[model samples]
Target: MLKSSLNKGLIEAGCDEAGRGCLAGSVYAAAVILPEDYRNDDLNDSKQLTPHRRYELRKIIERDAVAWAVGVVTHEEIDKINILNASILAMHRALDGLKVRPEAIIVDGNRFKPYNFIPYTTVVKGDGKFMSIAAASILAKTYRDDYMDRLAEEYPQYDWISNKGYPTKKHRQAIAEHGITPYHRKTFRLL
Candidate 1:
């Protein structure tokens, strides 16, 4: 079972991002603030869950969370600032949209730029250890996957509907055959 919150008696938001390693589409981030007593045995890191499970958990998180929001940074932005900074910026944007201010933040990864002086703790694989971070991971992964599915309609040659813009062998092969699309990150090595 995952812990409810990193600190007691304080509103805490868990932050996580998805698609940072994808060769196409935007990166997405989510900030989720769950009630201190929130519990779900099925909740875990987004990558650990199947698509159906993640979607189901996303609905539960959205309905039960104190506040939850998703933020996105386009491929263009990623090329400009680099994926690391873009991922942090996306998290900040998600935090900006929260209805309730968080007293502290627990992030799934080791790196994060400070958000308006809010104290944050970075945990390697924190999503699997904290309920709130797991919830955020579900939101970010589902949202980014949805975006890529939509983009796949316009560029089916890349097979984004199946690969979801990850740098899969077939995705790279498509890039070689079809060349880059407007959605492909220019800074990323496409070959």
Candidate 2:
């Protein structure tokens, strides 16, 4: 079971990003501040859940959370700022939309550029350990996946609906066959 919060007293927001490792598309991030009493048996790391389950949980989290927001850093921005900075920037943007400001932020990775004067704690694999983080992960992944799926309609060559911009075998083959699209990150080498 994922813990509800890291610190009981602080109004904490859990932060996570998706598509950071993808070869194309933007990196998406979400900051979720769930109620302390929130609980769901299916709640876990977004990666562990199926697409259907993630979507179900995403709706629940959006409806039940105290505050939540998703943000994206475009492929062009990711190329210019680098994935790490772009990911953190996306997280900052998500936090910016929160109706309830967090007292402290708990990010799901080992590195984060601080948001404003608010202090933050970075925990590796935090999504599996904290409910709010897990919720954030689901929101980020589903939203980004949905975006890629829509893009797939416009650029069927990339097959983003299947690979979701990841450097999968078919995606790399598509890159070799058709060349990169404007959405593809030119700096990223697809191996």
Candidate 3:
């Protein structure tokens, strides 16, 4: 079962990003604030769940979250700032869209560039440990996957539908065959 919040004493938004390690497409992030007592045994790390389960959990999170938002850093921006900074920027953008300003933030990774004066804690693999983070992970993953699937329609050579912009063998082969697209991260080494 997933714990509802990292700190029950304060309003907190859980933050996480998806597609940070991808060779193409944008990095997506999500911030989700759940009630103090929310629980779901089906909740886990988004990567650990199937596409069907992630979609189901995403709907639940969207319906039940006190406030939630998603952000994206485009491929050009990712290449300009590097994936790490782009990930952090995406998180900041997500937080900017929250309906309720949180007292604190619980970030899924071990590093964050602090959002304004609001306090934050970075827990490695937090999605497995906290419900809010898990919810954020599901949102980010599903949203990013959906975006990539749409992009796949325009660039079928990348096979984004299957790889989801990850560095897969077939994706690399496609890069070698067709060359990079406008969506591919320029700074990333395709080989």
Candidate 4:
């Protein structure tokens, strides 16, 4: 049972990013402000849920949340600033898109750069512990996966539709065989 919010009195947004560890494609982040009463038994960390479940929850979150938006940092940006900074930048971009301002932000990971004078708390694995964070995780992961699936059509050699840009054995093998595509993060260990 994920907690609805970290602070009861304030409007809080949960933040999380996906594809930070991937070898290719952009990192995606989501900031979600769920209603205080929102609850769903199936909602959890995106990683723990199947693709079907994540997609299902994405629909639910989008429909039910007070405000939800996604942000994306491209592979070129990741190569320029490095993954950690890119991930944070993505989160900031997500927060920038929020229609409603949040009094507080609770992030999934331990490190997050502050946004817009808003107070933020970084909780290790907050996505699994907080409902809003879990909703954000689902949004980020599903959106990134959808992006990678489209990229896979253009660059079938990487098999991104299946691996979703993660450095799987087959993905590495494809990099070795066909060389890196424009989508591959050059700073990453592609081989």
Question: Which consecutive 10 residues in model 4 have the weakest lDDT in total?
Answer: 34-43
Candidate 4 ranges with C-alpha deviation above 4 Å: none
TM-score, each model?
A: 0.99, 0.98, 0.98, 0.99
Cand. 2 TM to true fold: 0.98
Over 4 Å off in model 3, which ranges?
Answer: none
After TM-score superposition, the amount by which residue 22's alpha carbon in candidate 3 deviates from its true location, in angstroms, is: 0.4
Best by lDDT: 4
lDDT of 3 at 140: 95
| TM-score of predicted structure 1 | 0.99
Candidate 4, after superposition: displacement of residue 42 in Å? 1.3
- For residues 1-191, what per-residue lDDT tens digits would candidate 4 score against the true structure? 88989999889999999999999999999999999867888889999999999998899999999999999999999999999999999999999999999999999989998799999999999999999999999999999999999999999988898999999999999999999999889999888
lDDT of 4 at 106: 97
Off by over 4 Å in 1: none
For candidate 4, the lDDT comes to 0.95
lDDT of 2 by residue, 1-191 (tens): 88988888889999999999999999999999998767887889999999999999999999999999999999999999899999999999999989999999999989998788998999999999999999999999999999999899999987899889998899999988988888998788965
**Candidate 3 local lDDT, 21-69, one digit each (tens):** 9999999999999977877788899999999999998998999899999
